[model samples]
Target chain A: MDKVIKGKVWKFGDDIDTDLITPGKWLGSPELKDHVLETEDPDFPKQVQKGDVIVAGKNFGCGSSRETAPEALLQMGIVATFCESYARIYYRNSIGLGLPPLIVPGVSKEIEKGDEIEFSFETFKLKNLRTGKELQAERIPDFLLEILEGGGQEKILKKKLKQKLKELRAKKE
Target chain B: MVRPMTIAEKILARAAGKEEVKPGEYLIAKIDLLMAHIAAARIVARFMGFPAKVRKVFDPEKVVVLEDHFVPAPTVFAANAQKMIREWAFKQNLKYFYDIKAGICHQILPEKGHVRPGMLIVGTDSHTTTYGAYNAAGTGIGDTDGTVAAALGELWFKVPETIRFVLDGKLPKYVMSKDIILKIAGDYKADVACYKSIEFVGKAAEDMSIASRATLSNFSMELGAKFAFTPPDNKIIDFLKGRTEKPVTSDDLVKPDEKAEIEKIYELDVSDLEPQVACPHTVDNVKPVSELKDVEIQQAFIGSCTNGRLEDLKIAAEILKGHKVHKKTRLLIIPASQEIYKAAIKEGIIETLIDSEAIICNPNCGPCFGAHMGMLAPKENCISASNRNFKGRMGSEDAGIYLASPAVVAASAITGVITDPRTL
Candidate 1:
């Protein structure tokens, strides 16, 4: 994982729930990537470029624990999300899927749409290149950082569990 | 000196094998249950993506897989997903597997005795907080977290601050537990309890039936509660007595100490409470039923993990006993589980609803999420008993959804408009 992330900003407002991110009607559809944030911003999926960042207001990703919410963002080439605050499960899902959901208080106010922002995972520092405004973000826990470092929980769990299986086989031998 | 711990702190402390736990501190805790539904198929697919020949779940007994979200396979895509989930459950030899007959994961988990006090449970669905009604620590998880918890029998948690809501005085006639939560949402708004555990205590909470208490815990998700609890009492014990094969006694009940540290306390007297409704677009945009005028509805749905219990059906039946559903509105009633459906049949509640021209669907999450069954058309308005009134939650983004109790839904169906149950 990179120590710093730099991306173009795609801004959203507070209380942008899972239903808005991934509507319930298209729960299991392959078309989910096309519908990501379609209700809230019809142009999001079509216009969002690779390595873009999502900046949103408080309680972002609030509502359902559908992994599809973050999965859609990841599928659409979103590198990370910066929110004033996050709903607990969405935060976990974002991190588990290898998307960094950085908590930067007043971030929604600091960054504007289309602004290029650079965030340092090491210093928890976020700088708006467009506005020249810098802010200190909340630190991600060391253990969670390890998950992010290992390229998310899926790869880590696969490696760990395979090792466990080998150990079990060795003990039996 | 050790500070007095709230129920969440004590439960997490016990699960983590620690003397105490405080807010903002993180710890790895052993999980008693790992639940997944239609979503488990994704976890299984992700797990199988690994090239390990010895892929095994930590404990099949702790895993619960149910097919409730996309039951009956509304689409070929959903059907294929369900097939994969069924095959994986068979291969894993999971101890707890339900194939759409059981019901929503949250409702059937308690009804079938999977939830126990002081246990830590996680699920792929957000409403898993419903288990907290039994004094268990339950929270929602996503697929990757679910997959890891399925492999390792433990998950990490950041101890959340507790908010204590104390309710006393008698609930007025026709006012249900749904109203209490709606009133709270109206006053405090959603996100007031974000990432916090909310503990409901006091006489009114104790007086609520198990089903009603489940409603309180279930809808707390709308308030952004990571976990919600109504202290266990004789009511919970009695409810679990014959329902669970495992021996559960009153001594196993977990409660907060009198001096437990809570971040906030809210005291409410429910004697004067009215029937509350969460209007369209958001759960917190709530208003008393009497204040909502001329809001005509095209559909009325009474079901979901939130309020689909037999008690809710009985309330709806009582209001619709003799009256016919308005010609302008279509009424759909779904019991939460097969057991609740059977119980409603035995009690003649189903017959009364059927006589009123209400459509009774199978016990699944019917149309609450707009996945299947009764979806609202463009510009249509629906008064529903299910939680969540988020925009586009129940089909057409232009459609409006008003959330209320079963009685209100039934009464509104009869009048073709949002009506106070007492007026019916």
Candidate 2:
């Protein structure tokens, strides 16, 4: 995982729930990425570029336990998310999918929609490149950080499963 | 000496193999049950992506897979997904697998005796908190987390601080557990209990039936609660009798210590509570049914994991008996599970609903999350007993959804508008 991340911001308002991220109607569709956030902003999927970040108001991911929400954002090339706060399940899903959803108080007011921001996971600081304002984000716990550093839960689980299988094979000899 | 511990703390401590646990402490805990529904397809995909040739679930007996989300296969996409999940379940040789016949996952867990006190349960659906009604620690997780837990039978958690809600006084007529939870949401807002466990206690809570308690815990997710519990009483003990496959021991029951640390205590009197409704776009935008009298609805749905139990159907039937649904509005009644469906039929609740012109659907999630059966059109409004009312939840983004209790939904269906059940 990168210690430092820099990206352009796409701003959203409070209570931007999972439905707005990926609607229920498109649950099992293959082209789900094309409809990502289409309910909130139809142009988001078309206009969003790789390595961009999302900055939003309070309770950014507030509905459903769909990992599809964060998965869609990752597919759209969103590097990370900065919100005032997040619903617990969404925060977990985001971290599990290797998308860092950092809680930075007053992030919506400090950064503009198109502003270029640089964030450091090492220092837990976010700096607005345009205005030169810096904000500190809440530190993620060490256990979750370890998972994030290992490329999310999938990679970590795979490694553990491999070790288990190897041990089982040796035992059978 | 060991410090006092809340019910959530006690459950987590046991799962984590610790003598005691405090809020904000992170630890990996053994899971008693791991559940998945149609989204099991996603979990299976992720689990199969691993390079290990001998991949296997940690415990097949503890894993439950249900086909509830897109039951009966509404579309080709849904059909393929269900097929994938079915094949995977067979391949894994899981012990508890329910096909489309089984109702919603949340309702089936407790109804079938899969849930018990002091257990730590996790599912892929957000309403997994419904299991908390059994005095267990239940919370929802994403597909990847579910996959990991299925493989390892354990997951990490940050022990949540507990919020205590003490409800006293008797509930007035037409008001139910749904109203109490809606009132709490209106008063405290959605994120007030974010990442926290809520313990419901006091006279009113103790008097509620197991079904009513399920409503309280099931809807706790709407308030951002990590877990919600209505302490086990004799009522729960009776409900668990003969229903569980495993024996229930005295060690399974747990309670909060008298001196346990609670983040906050809210005492509410429910003597004068009214039917509450959560308006479109957000669950926290709540109002009494009386205040929404002028809002007309095109459909009134009474079903979901939130309030699709037999108790909810009886309430709806009582109001709909001998009355015809308004010509302008369509009424959709869905029992949460096949067990509830058969019971309702035996109790004549289904006949009463059908006589009132209500379309009784199968035991599945019917149009609750807009997956199938009864989707709303553009500019249409619906009064649903379901949990969520977020934008585009039922169908089109232009359609509106108002969430209320079964009585309120039934009354609204008869009037073709959001009507108070007491008024009817």
Candidate 3:
């Protein structure tokens, strides 16, 4: 997780579903973003640069249990996604995959396309470098934060596996 | 006296090992049951890789794997994915792995009593909320989160706010649970409860059969509800009594507090409502079936976790008893579970459906989400009982799917157009 992230914003509208991010039909493709946001913005995958922040309206990533939705965005160098709210499964997917998707309620009203916004998901605050407006974002639970900081579930699992094994042995004793 | 707990609060608190939980509280709750579909089990297994988190499952009794989506493998790719799940389940010594034989996970879980009242359940498939029909707090999770639950017996959750939907009156004769939910979905919008849970209450909800209640909870996904549940009733209690080893009692039931922390309440009276349909591309684009009577359909499908229960099949059978499908349209029926298949067979629902020139396949998702069987060609139209009518969902992106209930689909299959079941 980046302590501070600064990037150009890519704005999306309400209910940006997993199909738009990583359609199930195209799940295994290497060029994931090839069809990413193709439903809404056909030009997104081609023009999206590294270190970009995607700010979306309500219920971002609504359908399916596709972790590839966030993995594709992260692999394409999306540093963060700020939305009014998120689908429950997608929110967990983002955290487990180490994508910084913060819920800053009304950031959508304050930020615009191509605006320069600086924020840290851990800090739970954002500064609009362009408009000089500051926004407060929702803070996540510590356990989830730990997973994000460790870079994903795999890294966290690597450590927990050893600990869990010890606990199992201790239980037997 | 202890504060009466909402079903969701009660289940979450019990799972989290807490006395009480607030609406927005976050906690790590233990999963009593975690279901994995082949769609996600294979993905999670692949991502974990190598020797993985454990050689065998952390707890075999608490996990289930169902191969419903592309069963019998619509394509070689799907078969290989199923192979991976089969191999992993066998190696992990998982207790319940219903390969293509079992049918959809949602229908099977309840059929097998895997879901019970006041439990914290999770599934890889989004419609896992289907268990909520039994008064459990179950929601969908992705493969990554599901993998964690599989490795450990627990997962974290931000307790979702609750919205109570009170149904005040009985549904009209032609209208079904599908119509009621479609009306709600359209009125509330797909994002109504984006990250929240919705509870169905009142006399109508209590009066509904376990199967009918499932239709309401299953379509909660169409509204993006984290979960949808009804307070346990006699049907649920009776269903669980025979299934569980323990002597069950009312103490196992959960109910909402008089002052439960509900975000909002939406009261609906359905005595006068008509059968509804959600048109293509969006679940919220709903309209009355009568208004869309001119819309012609080339296909009609009845079966999915949403409306493929024995009762649903019986309704369709009643409509198709002496009639044949229209020449221009094809009708397909895929039972939601093998148990449903047997029950429908015993009741002669299959004979009626088959004698009516309907194509009944094994219990599988069956083109519900474009995975396999009975695909639609370009510009073709379908009226289906499945949940979603999303664009390009069934087959070709150019095809259109209109969602209705089983009876409605059966009637429309005979008409080759959208026809309200009331007309029958």
Candidate 4:
């Protein structure tokens, strides 16, 4: 598993709902990638490069549990989100989809918009390359890390079923 | 060690196949019931990609699929999604399929006697918590999470702390359960119950009707709660009496442990409270009904799982009887289920509402979703009985949405703007 992620920070405030991330109207759109985060920041989909990180204040992903919220970020080449807190469903969806939402302590206030951030999943630390300050985030939960290693819950189920079938075939033989 | 367990923790512990559980602990619990609206089910069925249909599931008897979101297929996508799920449910031999003739999933589940105390129910929509009114340990889930829970019959949860909301007094006339929840959401702030369960107790909760209880649990999401419940009171038992084959006594209900560590406690006196409304842009931006008394509104909507019930419809019908909706305003009434629709019709409540020039529609989440029908035009203002009042919630981002009770929404529809229901 990749433990280190370095990216340019994109800032947002509290309650960054799924509607703003990817509105309901654009749920099945092939052009969703272009409109991703368009409601929040018009330039986001255009300017966001391959390793951009979203750092938002408390209660991030606050409304409506749409998987498209994280899908929008992932498809736009945004890799990670650092929030003070997260709504339960959105948090579960993010880790289950392989896009990790790390709960960093006050990283939103400490880091400037567009600052270079180096995140270490193992150490639970974020280094501000521009400001030369280090901030600590909560250690990734063990269950979530395990899920990530298994390529998320979907893969885990596939592997579990496959193993079960193999065991049954071997026993029958 | 499990020191003490609330009704929620106990149900979770039992479902997790453990003797006990505590707050903040994560466990994979067995799901007793799995439900999804047609739109959400379609998304879940196709979540694995490649234009798939979820033709087989673990237990067909345990799964429920409801065609409530877009009943007759408003959009092409909705039509396709509903058709695919209907076909898939049939293939899976799903036990409960409330086709378009039925209404909202939350309302129909209880009305059909599927919900029971001590059960662990999971649904694709955010208002699944509404089942908590039956004393079931229920919580809303996202599409992907719901799909997994439905297929595998299990889902992971981080046990939440409890917030005890003690409703100490009798609710005065015109102050419905909707008002109490709004007061809690507005006064106490959204995070008060965030990641926690709010266990309702005291006289008010005990006296509230089943439909009214539904409203409280339905809006629990506004508090950011993981779960919210009032132990299945006598009202719920009585409602289920003949509808259910099994004997349901008060003893079947569960309660929170007296010794359990509650994160916080709040006492609300319903008798002293007035009508409340959540203003534009947020459910938590609540104010007294008088605050916006003069603000003109173009429409008043009484529907959604939050308010579309016989009890709520009666409240509107009573106010609109022998009177007309304001010429400047149009009143839209939606019964939550075909069951609610029939009940209102039998009682002549629907006729009275129609006589008042109120347009009635079948049970579905209409304007609440800003889809199909009832889209607000630019700069339009509406007073709605639905849950969320978030900006662009009903349509154009420029439109304003205000949340209130059915009685308040109806009274306001008569004169336009926000009017206190007490005056009428």
Candidate 5:
């Protein structure tokens, strides 16, 4: 059983760089507990809900492949991200941190702020709870689905390595 | 009605056993190159913790290690991070190595001929897209993905469909890759291509040198593209001439298949374009320098892998030749590497810059990141050739940063606000 929590959407245009996500100046400080709240614009992180899904336009993480960008999102308790597109480094960082980055086509045009939506990520669809209009996303590939199920790339490697070790021991026996 | 496959699609389809890969389609391909930064220390520690059995050199010749970022550490933390990377390189026996005294990884990688056209490149740093100038499909990866690529020279990629950018005409006199990319950034406002690869074609791309084209493809990541590229031609062949020991002939050249499909097409004519600036708070918040002219700057940094090449230095020196940098503005010029520095000195580009009162630093990614020497005070503003202008990204959250081309940075060092290099 999973929980879906929706809030008033805050739409940010594409190419939201890692610098804005987690400023390097903050890296000087050792504190990792909700540093997102202290961003130049304080309202952004606070407006987000614990389980809220961020819907972005494109190139969502661009410039400076620092891990702090996704770390800030996770620290804010953001459960998933639905973007029309994402930067290569940013997408991998989010997935590595066990955050779902759903690639939806043309979803940025359909949704507006204050739209009450029901997102069934398991089914890969977003429904307007008030209007009952469902938006479908193109199917995510099986390998990515497997990584998502196995808890990201790092975890998948761990599981594979473990299985390989077991097989090697059995062969020796 | 016929839909022609884009150049990117044609290349990817040739490699892809499967028919088509749309935007969301995740098709895996064998990685061609693996690049890592100093953070490789942590990745090495992970491998040591859980050693992979029967591991020799995973793509030994293809892997490149560079200590570019976090150089000249001001604090003990950065020093330790550098130490970790040094120890790992020794244990891994990496062949292509660039230490802290060297320069930015992206600049070093291609200058040394590690980047090749049609090759898929992955780096630990995000700006790895800079290598796309060599016509390689390059992108950034995190520590985990990097470590995996180090252990197994392969990582899965969903061959990205291409967005064909057909350049309509030539650029204006002062307009360079920075303006073209910034104009494109404004056209799309950050989300246009998102996860797609952008392929630059037509006369505009052909006319630009590999370094200028590198700036365009490099910052394409700034527009949310997975990566961007321009196929190598005689220019790339010329660049790779002496740099590569193994002569790569055109016979082995990989070209796009004729029967491929393109996802979308974008066209732009940058003729008569002006110098652009990404104002503070966001790279996407772009505007021409004329729009926000006379905004005082405390610093003017003219280097980074982004704009630290010899051409960039020449452009800056040309502007700063006889003129002195503004009294309040500290003009810092760092070459991409010792090689570029030596070339600039040999060509008298260094004397021209020094005569203009510009502070010439060593070849490294120093103050562009604001880690050690160039940290800003609150309310300070900087005009920089480095990428990204997010709030507090350079030094202080209150510090305002304007991203510009090397020409603009040098010109601004003269006038002290965002000034167009052409006007000067």
Candidate 6:
């Protein structure tokens, strides 16, 4: 299992809604690679690199729960999100897409932009590489953990089911 | 442990056929009503790329497509996007398409009778939960979930525990559902009640009309709730009368037991409430209008799924009747739909607003999106009846936004400042 990812962090203020993240206009487009590279803040897309973490204040996904929001994050290769809180659907959408949204109640105030950070999924902890400070977040369920570990829930389930069928057929033979 | 299930849990359990449901449990549900928006065009494009060898559109009639968010695109980019969506809708053979000329999707759905009480309504839009005001269980979904729901007419759900808000006493003058919801956000912050389905009850919600109840249910999304609802009552029954063709028959009822369990409950008395505004950069940065003294606005918008109802229009028309908007201010009014547009004309409300110099636009989400018609310039400030006020929400990133009730927006249009509608 992938235990930790290290990357520079981009910090944002409260109410970073889905519209600002992926935007509505991009929905109709065939490919999101370039658009995902162009983040909401006019200057962001170029600044964000693959595998960077997004650190934000409260109500991170406050508005519409557009899938584009998570898709953009994933397309940009965002590894994880550390926020004060998340909107209900956005939280679920991220997990469904195999991305992690860590709920660190006060991490928004603690972390800053360009700060290298270490994120751990197994222990549900984030370590600020710059400050040597660490924060813990709420742990996800085992089932969801299995999905995240095996890429995504659908992919994992399909793989396990196939393996189980193969095993039963072999036993019968 | 003997604990009672909340209204939210009861509804989720009934749909899922479980005795009890928790917050994070994932289970499949039999969706009663499924809705889609212009964003569903993405699903269509994907379907074109990789055709789904599955059932298509659970119920085409139950799905609705509203070309809101980016209506009358300010740039060629938005225009191109809208064009793509229109073409996709035609190919899909989905009937409930509301083009940019139609109106905001949320408002058009209930106005068109696709939503009613005691049913599960799912949409691609977050504010789809607003339908719960009529006592239906509705929530928003992502494009993938929407596609699955569209094709299968079924999706999974974890019965969420509910938070009951018992509001007592009559509201003071200048206070309305908008003020009450802002107060709830102020007290609870944005995510304090995250993932909890909210049920607003008591005299406040009870006495309110279906329109007023819609305003309350609409903003529950701002409080980070999965959905918001008020139980079925006479008001809903009365509202259904206008939509006889889409009326709920006896088989559509799911009456909660008198002894149904609730997870958490809170009581509030807002009899002496004041005009409220959600300040810039955050919807939960709520404050009474009087608290932010001497704040002036360059523009005022009175429409969106939130305050675009007939009652909302009439009240604004009443305030603006025979009173001209301020010379320094630009005011815009958008009816919720073509149906509302025609009704306003018949009732003389349209003439009243026009006489007051308010620029009336089509029923789409015009200036609310900061696109097309009324984009605000840098450093400009606006007071709107829309749901959100994040940076760049209405125009430039530097533009400031304040959210208020329709009355307050109309009054601000006249005074060109953050003034109380009652004072006007």
TM-score of model number 1: 0.98
Per-model CA lDDT versus the true structure: 0.90, 0.91, 0.83, 0.82, 0.74, 0.77
TM values, all candidates = 0.98, 0.98, 0.93, 0.95, 0.88, 0.88
What DockQ score does model 4 reach against the true complex?
0.41
Per-residue lDDT of candidate 3, residues B221-307 (tens digit) = 768788899767667888777766564567777777788888999999988989999998788889988789479999999998898
Over the stretch B1-424, how does candidate 1's per-residue lDDT look in tens digits? 7789999999999999999989989999999899999789888898787656656788999998998986788888888899999999999999989977798889888888888888899999999888888888889999899998998888889999999899999998789999999999999988989999999999999899989999999999989899999977877777777777686888889988889989999999999999999998889999999999999999999999999999999999999999999999999998999999999999999999999999999989989988788888999999999998888899999999999999899999999999998986
Model 2: residues >4 Å from true position, as ranges?
B51-53, B249-251
**Rank by DockQ, descending?**
2, 1, 5, 3, 4, 6
Minimum summed lDDT over a 10-residue window in model 2 chain B is located at B47-56
Q: How well does candidate 2 match the true structure in TM-score terms?
A: 0.98
Q: Which stretches of candidate 3 lie over 4 Å from their true place?
A: A29-33, A109-115, A127-134, A141-143, A165-173, B1-4, B43-53
Question: Please, what are the lDDT tens digits per residue for candidate 4 over residues B18-69?
Answer: 9888888989999989878854554446444421323246698888888887
lDDT of 3 by residue, A14-46 (tens): 877776687655555455569888767777888
Worst 10 residues of 4 chain B by lDDT: B47-56
Residue-wise C-alpha lDDT for candidate 6, range B1-424, written one tens digit per residue: 4245555665676677777676667777878776666666666654554323332465666666767766667667677767877776676677777777667877777767777766787888788878878778888887666765676666767667677888889988667899899888888787756787888889887888888888888888888878788766777777766774666654464555556556678888888889899989678889998887778899999888889878888989999988999999989998888888899999999999999999998878776655456778888899999888876667677789999999999999998888888877
Docking class of 4: acceptable
- Residue B312, model 2: lDDT of 96
DockQ of each candidate's interface versus the true one?
0.76, 0.80, 0.48, 0.41, 0.49, 0.34
Query: What is the Cα-based lDDT of residue B171 in candidate 4?
Result: 82
Model 2 DockQ class: high
Query: Which 10 successive residues of model 3 chain B have the least lDDT summed?
Result: B46-55
Q: Residue B107, candidate 4: how far off, in angstroms? A: 0.5
DockQ-wise, the better of 1 and 2 is: 2
Give stretches of model 1 more than 4 Å off. none
Better of 2 and 4 by TM-score: 2
Instruction: Judge the docking of candidate 6 as incorrect, acceptable, medium or high.
Output: acceptable
Q: After aligning candidate 2 to the native by TM-score, how far in Å is the CA of B165 from where it should be?
A: 1.2
Model 3 chain A, TM-score vs. native: 0.89
